[model samples]
Target: MATFDSFFSKRTLIGLALGQFVSLVITSTAFSSSELSRRGISVPTSQSFLNYVLLAIVYGGFLVYKRKRSLQIKWYFYLMLAVADVEANFLVVKAYQYTSLTSVMLLDCWSIPSVILLTWLFLNTKYRFRKFVGVAVCVAGLVLVVFSDVHSRDRGKGLPHFKYGSGGSDPVKGDVLVLSGAMLYAVSNVSEEFIVKKGGRVELMAMLGLFGAVVGSCQMYPEILANI
Candidate 1:
């Protein structure tokens, strides 16, 4: 292993910074095309930031490598992460097709309850009633947000802008899908937290990153090939 001085050397930081910059540029460009190809899904840049966070995970794994812990990777946890990642993205995109961002985000409030239960069940994590109250307060705020959005939409030139069944879609169902996706995400988070407590985050994350990529690729490749 490198000495602390060497690991924290100016040369090391410079290299890391340069590598991050290059990675950011590459991922930005690649996903830009992916976004366009999927249709004009103009996601809020801020919200989409996490979508590109896999790169950071990859970098973190490398840091673990430098620390020279264990390099062996598990594939199962990675598979779960990959499935969760793709499902969440798919849910968000499909929700956008049916509902307003406001309603979708409101329903994502489901994550709070889902995650709390997840922690209690899997991690044995606990919280006071006050914490539950805090979650309730946040959920109420989310409801208000959706109400405001719906009101604004109703006042606009077109209200209930989407349809229910054929051709187009419905808003309420979109909210449900968002909630489902959020629940899945919470499950993934809790699962990873459990995994982290048991194993090294670096190796686990690297494995998860690679596994998710492969799983997502398998799901996507058939569709792409069918299109061609």
Candidate 2:
């Protein structure tokens, strides 16, 4: 009871509110991405590329001004992290082209379990039994979500834009993409956590922005050329 009461602390409530706000922002972005796809504009890489540029200009500039401090981690590590982050963002957004926003959001929860496993395996993190129970619950929820999508399709109630087995929009393919992207997101999140703990938030964001911009630009240019 005391442990539960601690969660009601003002600081904790503030943290919870901030986290919820971030979640809402992310959901809003997902809706925007889906709307873009619905409009026949599917430039997932381009979208991420612009965000990376802004991050680079904002955070990267801070790092440049603080020239006294050098990077704590190696550049190659940030390069790998940037690639994973960029690809994860691209895959999740691209999935908007093939699935309902609801399914995409629900399936993205796969990242929770992926993160738990990665942190346990690579970071030597340990969890209590309740954490496992939470994970099991999440898995059950995901199973039900997939089953619901399948049932909807079988009943011909799936979205008109996403017909099962169709080349243009396959829900199964989109789900797979979301799961793949979630796994990559786990990798990026774990790596970022490790780097931030060792170095600092500024260093992590600066390097991530710099490398992410470069990687995003490389992927974006080809996508633009293909569209043209």
Candidate 3:
């Protein structure tokens, strides 16, 4: 007979994987839709503001509404995480605007190494030599992808454009920014894990979404105020 632990292990793993897949699909679809909307269409500031308002509500609801009773949230930690989260997005978007999208995407791959290093440092996690080698190989693959940014120089269609080197599109600056964003995201992930391990209640997807929406709305308050 299978033990309860064994049964749960399989079920939990499957659920987690499925949730991740679904989340990835949803996220990718949203980005694709955003890009399509941008194509040959100039969105007005009012429209963008309205979009942000909707985004805030959507994210807040998705991230933190349902798990109210058991949600042992530490606001300070969340604040730090939120700041990093905001900065990461800003940096990546800026990088995208200033350089080729291909370069930005390629440089974002640094997150793997960033996460491993951070996990080792903060979480005190250890890895086998093979895992370290695997990370190295992955980083090498990222370098190859960066090299292939040559293909991205044709933009305004679907693909990203590239302008490598100085005075054109500095891959160095763009990659650095994207790399930083990836590292920040990794840190945020590890921090969330830490939070959960420390008995912070399992925030339902809906709850998380809600919290994210509220927080995102708050983030835009300054801009809203400025415009007003």
Candidate 4:
């Protein structure tokens, strides 16, 4: 009875609700990216560019209203963070061009282990035995997913079949892109968490929004030109 009550506690329920909301948003983004790829449109950077712009406008407005004399964190640090964030978004969205949505979502779990290691090494975070067990389970699941993909490819004899998006797309390449993006996501998440804890959420968001928009814009320019 106590365990059940704790599991369904108000805070726990709220957390679960928030988690589901985030999951829905992420799934929707993946679906949109896949749909665009199906229609032969692959502007991954452009898709994320507007989001950064919105963040800049909203949070940056708050900072301007507060009228702080100087930023708590250095501008260059945010620049690096934004670069990682932009590349992470780019790679994950781009993965939809060559992989199944299911595979992209599953392989994106690679960020869990990456985040664990990053926090431990950079932030000196300590984990309990249960946390390690959880991470181990996640890794095992990822291994099984990879094995299944490889087995499927073997059975198909390396022929390009319509598994997900467009025909002739390579799932392996997409998986690699997702994993790479996941690593960058881990880096960005850890750094952002640390900075936010030390500084202020408003400042962090404003700077990230500012730098992310610039970085995303720089990358999207070439993409736009290529598409044109």
Predicted candidate 1 versus true structure: per-residue lDDT over 1-228, tens digit per residue: 699999999999999999999978855653453344346443322233344358447755585557665544455666777678667666655566556544664566678888998899877897999999989898887667555544443444353554322112355556666777888878878877877766667655666666655555555555455445
Each model's lDDT: 0.62, 0.86, 0.58, 0.86
Off by over 4 Å in 2: 1-5, 157-168
Pairs that collide in candidate 2 are none
Runs with alpha carbons beyond 4 Å of true place in candidate 3: 1-71, 144-168, 204-215, 218-228
Q: What is the TM-score of each candidate against the true structure?
A: 0.62, 0.90, 0.60, 0.91
Cα error of candidate 1 at position 34, Å: 14
Cand. 4 Cα-lDDT: 0.86
Clashes of each: 1, 0, 24, 0
Query: What is the clash count of model 1?
Result: 1
What is the TM-score of candidate 3?
0.60
Q: Write model 4 residue lDDT over 1-228, tens digit each, in one string.
A: 369889999999999999999999989988899898878887999999988898899999999999657887888999999999999999999988877788889889999999999999999999999999999999899787666665555566555554433222677777789899999999999999989986689889988999999998888998888778
- 3 against 4, candidate with superior lDDT: 4
In angstroms, how far off is 100's CA in candidate 4? Answer: 0.8
After TM-score superposition, the amount by which residue 200's alpha carbon in candidate 1 deviates from its true location, in angstroms, is 2.3
Q: Which regions in candidate 4 have their CA more than 4 angstroms from the true location?
A: 1-6, 157-168
**Lowest-lDDT window of 10 residues in candidate 4?**
159-168
lDDT tens digits, residues 96-160, model 3?
44455545555776877888898899999999899999999989987775555443344323434
